[model samples]
Target: DNFLGTLGGPGITVPVVGAAFEVGIELAAGGVEVNLVVDASSEFRTTSNVIANSPAGRDDRVVVVGAHLDSVAEGPGIQDNGSGSAAILEIAIQMANQQISPRNQVRFAWWGAEEAGLLGAQHYVDQLSPRDIKDIALNLNFDMIGSPNFVRFVYDGDGSDTPLAGPNGSKNIESVFLDYFAAMSLPVEPTAFDGRSDYGPFIEVGIPAGGLFTGAEGIKTPDEAALYGGTAGDQYDPCYHLACDTFDNISLQALDEMSDAVAHSVMTFAMTTSAVNGTDKGKGLGKFKSDMEYRGSHLVK
Candidate 1:
């Protein structure tokens, strides 16, 4: 079955969690909370499931940090998503260890069926109400962040074309990344938002989105290689969608750097989101408070 109709579909990871909660409540009413239960009918019936962790903030606002868990049929997808997923897990664990309570709630989601086209992310977005969505400040999607041979690039979600505009005077999410890249002196190619990965859902609903991709599918031209440090004639990530995308295809140094960068960005945003371009002060709380003045006002005749 062509499950998702279009490119991306729901991996059903969270939905399965929701279902498990339903089943657990039903079963536990008899007074025994089973430690290990299996549900063959659940959408995420795979041996592997994305583990999610949430740090609730004081105001009930949320910021999402995401990576995909499942691999493609063609390859193990270690570099494609495994690296990103591991990074998210590490960041979550670090934050928890630090006991740093963020100003906004932070959610780490590991999506499934992304290669089948961004499914897990799509389903989660589809289930939210406008009010529910407004509580989301922005989504940081890490699809492919580690490749032994690749060029690092951040999403230019707001670049010309359709323009990555958002509701309620949302900030420009892309700038934060650009600034980070510039600070690091890394040669970055801004990948346009092409509805290619999980960031699709956030873009569709006017949520400011940004992410890092260590090149996949695209080739690195001589010019790009000269700017970055890869072979000019080779594909950006030669193993992309191929069976060679295993652990050996990744770089420990690259993974460590990217993971640290991701952690910095996540922590920075969680602590003081008021400075981020695409985030609105009220979006985190789902309401416009009387005291928070609107930066842009209309001309009332």
Candidate 2:
């Protein structure tokens, strides 16, 4: 008899559970080889949500800000994405409270099924018409911004340090955060545009996308600790994807700073996407890259 384990559906490559004892025995026998079998016979379903939002008059030019709202089965997911969801929700409320209007329409989205894959976002992008797609000025994504042992990580939109680069204007979007951090005298570092989050869908269709992440499963280094004031030789979020990712898993300081930055970017782009997409009615793209490259210099020794 074979023990069966449930998988999270398509795109789930990692094993949910495995027998270490069996593997150990196989490994002990030098010439032993192992054959693993997977039974992924299950039903798949697609679910939808009520995408709540407040629209602007300039519907032709839309600026989308999104965050995933779901958590892993194990925990509350407060830090993994609850931090991001809460931040955007508050920003939207404040925007409404202030009654501030913008040159471009700002649409805030709380995506579903982001943990399984970028399904919610991908479905949204697929449903838009070509004209509607063209109307989108840019996308801003926020994920895992309140990791306990955090670092200020901005997405590398210019592809200077990462293999993945967003469509034109992404570099400029990146510059927005970099400029904000520089102005605040906050130390910031570049995270790769690896499409590991909700932004992946928007960028796939050539939409300019950029966002912020504090940290995740990646370990913190001595250099990062020196720059960001956290313990070295520790995972950015020790409770990542685990049941321990409760309310206490968050860093209050990290959440506050990232929320402020989120508001700054939303307000800035709302007034003028000229710095992002371009001033020429979205015909031109900004090519400027921020001048902060400390790549390998910040890694653990």
**Prediction 2 global C-alpha lDDT:** 0.80
What is candidate 1's TM-score against the reference? 0.72
Summarize candidate 2's per-residue lDDT along 137-250 as a digit string, tens digits: 889999999999999999988777777667888888888888788867899998988878999988888889999999888999999999998889999999998889999999
In model 2, state the lDDT of residue 87.
Answer: 91
Q: Provide the overall lDDT of each model, using Cα atoms, as 2-decimal numbers.
A: 0.66, 0.80
In terms of lDDT, the best-performing candidate is 2
User: Where is model 2 more than 4 Å wrong at Cα?
Assistant: 1-41, 273-275, 279-301
**Residue-level lDDT for 232 in candidate 1:** 77
What candidate 1 gets wrong by more than 4 Å, as runs, is 1-53, 58-60, 160-171, 273-301
Each candidate: RMSD to true structure? 14.7, 7.4
